[model samples]
Target: MATVTTDPFVGRLVDGRYEVVSKIARGGMATVYLALDRRLDREVALKVMHPHLAEGSDGAEFVSRFRREARAAAGLTHAGVVAVYDQGIDGETSYLTMEYVPGTTLRHVLQDERALAVGRTLELLEEILDALAAAHRKGLVHRDVKPENVLIDSSGHVKVADFGLARAVTEAASTATSTILGTVAYLGPELITSGRCDARTDVYAVGVMAYEMLTGRLPYTGETPLQVAFQHVNSDVPPPSDVEPWLPAELDVLVCALAARTPDDRPVDAGAALTLVRQTRAALDPAVLDRRSVPASSGTAGAVGTAGTDRKSPDSGATAVLASVAAVGAATAGASRAAVDRQAGSPAPAQPDSTPTTVLTGIGPASTAHLVTTSAQGDGVQHTLAMSRGDLAVDGPDDGTPSPRSRRRRAGWWWFVVVLFLAGAAVGASWWFLSGPGAYTAVPGNLVGATQAEAETTLRAVDLRSTVKEAYDDSFPAGTVISTDPPAGGKVRKDGAVNLLVSLGVKMLDVPTGLVGTTADSATAALEAAGFEVGDPVEDYSDNMPAGDVLAVSVPEGSSQPHSTVVQLTVSQGPAPVTVPQVVGLEKEAALKALTDLGLDPSSTDDYSETVAAGLVISQTPENGSEGHRGDKVALVVSLGPPLVEIPNTYGRNVTEAEKMLKDAGFVVEVRHPQGISPLNIVYAQSPEGGAGKTAPKGSTVVVNVF
Candidate 1:
């Protein structure tokens, strides 16, 4: 049963182009009416906001938002999305004309059926998500997503409606402290609190709706709308299986993840959510999807049980033939009734009775009414024929004579029977030859794994023709038969062509040459264009490759990979810098070990030092605390003990002579007097004195006594 609406504007015409037929439904924001577009001569649903909502400041603001959002929604074009035809204002009322759909809302369906089968629920949700994906692509957010907004037609095709009405109401209620206009259960936290909306906001609403669809109940309920809104903000949505334990765990995981309290937890948009839903649906067991236990009397027989129309008799052609035969039998019975009327001398036409009726005829007053009538009734297979002995009597037979002509007349019926028999045989033979078993032959044996030549030979052997087509197949080998058109063990007419799908082997695509040294996004696009799929990238430090640039590909360049194969990319983390270790003042062996531990190759050289001990490092190349990569070589100078020198004897020589002798001995010369000494004077005696065969470093300074 449908609700009857009789508003004052039911018979009014708006904008002279739309004629209002009748009000269909009333919602919080507007009343929907079934109207005719006079200009286009098509039916449309006219949603007109209440005049009171267009009066005050809040109402004015709501109407303004309605017009804007309606136009935005109208810009969207998709099969699953309900189209907005026009939006305008007629006098003080704002109305929008949209595609008039003949169907029930998802809310009505849920109310009637309570819960839907897993397959049906997913089917509906997929289409709804597709609609949302289209809107999200166009940068539109359907702030309200609930059962009430989704419409399912007679064919079970879903169309989503009422895209922007909920948000308009929210904007109108902004000034009021105690007002909430849409379904609080499906409202996102941001929409309820700050009236802000984005793609994720719609994702949240869809999650809540999905929960209701799966469990036949909402995740949250409250006495007041505000309480339900609070629940969406504060509480985590329980798993759908909590209400119906038999539900699949995947469904529960998807719902809980989508309905997360924070915006970041949900899918980036409806497109992403749709992908997960399709993947999850493909993994579900057939038994789970096919489960249905509802009774016909429960008002849910056609909801998810029957997909479209009901089945009648086995086929329609047989029913038509039977009906025609019945009609011919009725006409013959009518003629019999007319003949009986003439014999009985009744002028009134005979009428068919509900049951079989009897009619008797009399020739005169002395004659008996021996004509017993049996009416043709029911299926006409069993019918009555009026007959008399006189009707079959012949004039020659009355003379009690057995004439040859009378015998010939008796043989005429036999001739007619023989003709009928021959005619029936001809008809049956023609039917069999043209359309029966003779018209078609059994297809050849399996060709799925056969070679192309072998399959063609088999098909030709069976009196069938063959055509070949090539396609890439991941499983079958190249040039082998993947499948046949009529399929193996199927029927095909003799000489009919069998399309053989020959495998061309796996599809191969080369890696894009321009992918190297490019950003990940650019590389991904290039790879996809080349028919390869981009896999997760691995990060590593490179000495030559810059950071964030592709360092290497899993498949070498110029090599072919199967189409859609995941190609892993290695992105560079820039050069690997090594810390130069401090190796000076340490033992040569210890210094070499320290540098090697720091990933630096160490080499040592022996050097003589006057002040440093032997067997220790004097200095290192590249110095300490300098940047170098791993495996970089470091050169270290080791100290040998101070060089020993021999001193010549100068005690018997003059100051000048002793000074010259000491200076020539590879030692520094100094002049010393008792009080003051001349600048040019030389030493009289050396401090270590007159020692023989002493050697020193070439640049060493020596002191000599001078007078």
Candidate 2:
């Protein structure tokens, strides 16, 4: 049955900017996807944490540690380290946007080749150690050092990734059990036994990786992770030479020391380990360094045949010559080995070269004959006769020697043949020195790392013609020679063309369009993906742009810049804040002036109040000290004051009539009767006379006396 799997985040935009394109890989804690930072329009790797790891109990702590450690990883500025860009939490989904390295993981390469050549292995291992050294100097330990975390780019640059992530996860683990959080095969003894790790712990893992690379097998194995952890705690690591006998003694010593059960027994850090590795590599003989261990199951013949296939051939004609030379070397090697085995009377140690042979002969299709004599083992001269198969016959009795007369007859022609051979050698030697292959000289001196002019000059001095080819090289500066077609010490004929590969510096990349107006985060991610580093963004207030949006960039969009250039981004801090006008006590005109001067729009409403004079300002909406942007409206309430009326005198009038007079004056009216007498309808007296010049608030009441 086939299993079906789908990625839910594909084609989905996160935080309204990153568009996940495709899934790259899935790990225990997160699934990494290739995403496009749509606003900046460049690709990035998006590692989204699994939902289970981002929710439920202890999730917040895990998320917090993840963010803190991610920042620490970002601080690592080494070229051999992967750069972390951003970390964010959206709802229940926690994701980290990081550098999208275009290459295969070390694990993938190991799967294909099983084992690597010693020189190549050392080169990659040194790069890994370089990254670790940078981290260690900053007081950060990777905790997890395995092939899966190592990346080899297309240009053969190695980068170590996932720095500090394993430690973060282990810190957040709920249980205090001895279980470790990384690959069990590479765990150090201290981590498995005491749950403690340090820089030396990383060195131990590297040692394990070195052993695996050299022997094509892990030093320990188990069906369960716990079982593996137990072995790391209890058992001592064996030397790689135990599995691969061809490995040199120095390599075996290095691996064994690194994989020592005690952390104190190994190198103190990656830097210490690196020094020892270089020393050991330098001490190895060239033959030992070049020897590759072939799998016993594949057999020697199969390994040799696979090496000569089309897949391993180079584009240069020199490879063809080398192939022929290798064939001749194999033949001579086989004949020598056969003689050794026959003399020793025992089978020699198995060599991957080829099966040994006592003699080599071939019969021609045409009716022709040729005789060649060569010395063989056991004090005897053997004569090789080549003829058409139809003319050849084996009529000699088995194990019987030739007659004495026959041998004498053959000896009579020996002198004639010797003279003929000497004459041919003399002629061949004359031609070789005069105009043949031997007259050609070697292309001298190392061309790599030299300036193009220097390489050209060296080539010309050696009587070789030079042709220039340009390529991008991260390590080499522009105008320097990266390599040569005939290599440094290879031979070429006089005036022969030697192609020189000149470095054009790191590849140039164009800044993507639409960087402006996007959020600063998207722009930064885009710039980083295009091989440029983003400096801290400069923040400024803009009248028209919203806060947190990009205003401009130091480098314009659509311009080309060398890889890893620093680009400064200008981001808006939103419109300038407008101060609310202090118009509560000012008159309408005065209030309007204050509001307009502050770039605020003002409007008014009217109401009557006893405490305030007419036409004076009462209060304003968006009150004093309230913040508003430019051109934002502020509403004001204006005062109309209290109403004035003439109080009517009720001395000669009835209570009801007097009350009506006072009530019509915008005042509440009241009538008073004698203490014990029945109330009368007419009023005899009132508190205030309703005449001109008396003023009161519209709701204030007046009292009247009744008779």
Candidate 3:
């Protein structure tokens, strides 16, 4: 592996949108980064494939796998699964944008704490299996299930991530390659033996994880990769109780069954596994199986007995030795000869001269010691061992040769080999048996567009069995087949099963009608019946609508709605009217208060009134009993006094001008001419009112003397 210098996407932009922020993690085939989605205004985790992994000869194959797996994962709508938002290639880099989970992986947790409590461990395991169950139902098998692929969020939500190595069980067989898949520690027996995998394989991995969680150790260990792989294919998993006796037997059985050497021997799928786990957890008492109560020796060293004697107990020292061997084998499987030479133990029969010396150290004379060394040569590498007990030396040939005391020491190794061989034979026989009899194949058809009966018929004609899996499809017709397993042209045994995905169709909803102008409660009932959820209704006064009537709805009537749509109603509070209070004879302050109490505004106009006292209400607009709206202005006419009068006499002036002058002087104009007096006609009819000074109302009519 080369050390990454500068970030791969220092200046590159993806789809003219996402800009890489920083490299977050790098795996064997891809690198993940924290990126900014310029369009969505949010942070996203971007996974970019390595150029070699993307464009090499294997690139096309890997890319296809990636697309299929990503699509399947994206289709899942579970809280425990990371959401994939977008996927595309920017130049040479193929990347996927996903929800940025803010937390560490289970690997990080293990690295930090080494192990967790039983409750916490079970909680995390349950979440992981839940995610797997969802994926399995979608026909997605996460080939790579490991601690690093399981992410734990800050809120303690465990999400399964990294479906890059996932395989769609319905796809073509041309996709399967001979290259090793998944972490060796979690790889299932069938997967290691024949490269065959399915939901059961995933169950096996989950079982391995569960075992590790409880024991803080893997069930299998060896000095080489082949050894570990062989163990998966042959060895039976020692019950977790062997390592953690406090773990319930029910849980141990589940884990052990999942790690069974044959797929048939394990649970049917993730669902079955989950059911078993739930049942086991429900039936067992955690307090009775508490780790603190178990003896220290019975906990971590349960598989190894006391006094260093090779006991034949079910949880025996041999099981522990085999597990340790498998672990070491897996770790050194891909290493070079020089690397293998550094491990403990002596050389096997295949190599002798290359074997290294082994030594044991102890604190006291009573302590035991064993020799461990590694041997390497051009042909292969081997493990050698020697045990010394105070001058009693024990050495054995690498090829299971009998030592001086071989009769006793050889029993365990011989038994282990027999178990390994029998397990391998059993798995092979099961596969052969299943392949010949119950195998069935069907061509991939447009399940989404076909009716359920049509899909069943199509599958039946091909001797394939059909199982309808209901799902939501925006594009496919409802009650039709969405897709089929053993894709078109793919071959399966004659009786093999074919799974069909059926569409539930687009969700339909009725439009809430006649909700407008209805009361809040009435509208709520109507909308609820129409498959719409009703929100709180708002009220407002309207001048046109009657009080307490429905004014309008949030969603207009006749609109199609889905279940749970929130509809808001606006109810009318009335025409803003107020009952006018009577203020006809009250004092000015009292009259104003009365008008205000009726939600009406009052203003006063003062005048000199002879009938009413000062500061008293004389009259009011809209008469005192008329109804008015709140905040409406009302004018009050307060009497100041009777009208004042001014008298004027103009007999000699022009008749028209005289009338105007009289009118301007606040006097009533009257013209009277006597025939006899011409010269003094202007003064002939003059009266004492000509110069009269009497108070009257302004602009009031007055009597005038004219000739």
In candidate 3, residue 660 scores what lDDT?
79
Provide TM-scores for the models: 0.42, 0.46, 0.47
True-vs-predicted CA distance for residue 129, candidate 1, Å: 0.6
Cα-lDDT of candidate 1: 0.69
Estimate candidate 1's RMSD in Å.
24.3
Best by TM-score: 3
- lDDT (0-100) at residue 159 of candidate 1? 97
lDDT of 2 by residue, 1-707 (tens): 01113677788899888998888888876788888988778888888888776566777888889889998998889999988888888777888888889898889887877777777778877889889988976789999899999998889899998886778787776343334688889989898777888988998899889887776778888899888888888877765544554454456556765677777666567765665567557755555565555555553311212241221112221111000010110012222122212211111122243222222222244633333322232211122233332333233335666456645544544444456456546644654554443555555657888999888888888788899989997779999987665544444556787888999998888998899999999999988888788999999988778899999999879999877678999999987788785789898999999998887889999998888888999899999989888778999889988766566666677666777777776788766676544545666656655555656677577887665
**Each candidate's root-mean-square deviation in Å?**
24.3, 17.2, 16.1
* Predicted structure 3, TM vs. truth: 0.47
Better of 1 and 2 by TM-score: 2
What's the number of clashes in each of the models?
Answer: 12, 9, 48
Instruction: Please list the C-alpha lDDT of all candidates, in the order they appear.
Output: 0.69, 0.69, 0.62
lDDT of 1 by residue, 1-707 (tens): 15356688888999888999888888777889999999999999999987887776566677788888898889878999999999998878789999998989899988887677878878887899889988986778888788888988778899999877666766677664346567788988877777777888887888888887776778899999879988988777775644443444456556765676777656567766676567557656566686432434332322233232221122221110000111110012222222222222111112234454333222333321232222355322112223333443345666788588876764673454355446545644654455433555655667878999998888888888999999998878999997665545444567788889999999999887867788777887888888887888999987667778888888887788888579999998876779897879999999999888876788988988876788998999999899988668899999996766677777656777776776776677665676467665544556665565656664366656665
lDDT of 2 at 388: 37
Off by over 4 Å in 1: 1-3, 175-180, 292-707
Worst 10 residues of 3 by lDDT: 326-335
